[model samples]
Target: MDPIQRITTPTLDVLDALLTVDGPAWGLLVIKATGRQAGTVYPILERLERQGWITSSWDDETDRPGPRRRLYEFTPDGVDAARDLVAARPSAATPAPSAATPARPARSARPVTS
Candidate 1:
């Protein structure tokens, strides 16, 4: 992610969760940790992926119970950058979005045309 990008509260919570963990994190885990809905958590995850800050893969361990999970973790450079961003603004890390905050519009599968 660009250093100058505006880090939203949800994004900061996600980063904090990832940083505190020992290994790669999954979507549900992050969602619980941040106390944010899937809508808020997922878009931030996608944006982070597009910015090359994080990587994800399917958990293929057969020994594990339950369905496969998509796991995520920061890239080598992203580790430092994430820490810097969090440390730079500790007060910005709010875990929940207020009820007054407007929800983002859902994206449609079809492409828009003029």
Candidate 2:
């Protein structure tokens, strides 16, 4: 499987969600797990498929009430690459405000100009 070419927050989020599951996942499940909109999630899935990092297949359960879901799973090699990429990414759990990009000052900090 080919490694993902361009990595972004959305892409990484999708990958992270996939890694948590034990098997293939569907688009809606991924959207929920990543907290990404459908617009962002589908394109990311397509690109990852094109890059050969993942594969998709339609679920074949005939007993289901609605249409079959398209499930996505990382290719064997993709699992390893995804782990490495995530490990290298900066942690987003709780970003500290750096001096270069300071957080907004409190309302009381503003000068009491006439």
Query: lDDT: which candidate is best?
Result: 2
Q: Tell me, by TM-score, which candidate is best.
A: 2
Q: Please give the distance, in angstroms, between residue 46's alpha carbon in candidate 1 and its true position after superposition.
A: 1.2
**Candidate 1 RMSD computed on C-alpha atoms after optimal superposition onto the true structure:** 12.1
lDDT of each: 0.85, 0.88
Give the lowest summed-lDDT range of ten residues in model 1. 88-97
Q: Which digits, one per residue and each the tens of the lDDT, describe model 1 over residues 1-114? A: 555385777788888888988899999999998899999998888888888899999998999999999899999988898898879665554456779989899987997799
Cα lDDT, model 2, residue 15: 93
Count backbone clashes in candidate 1: 0
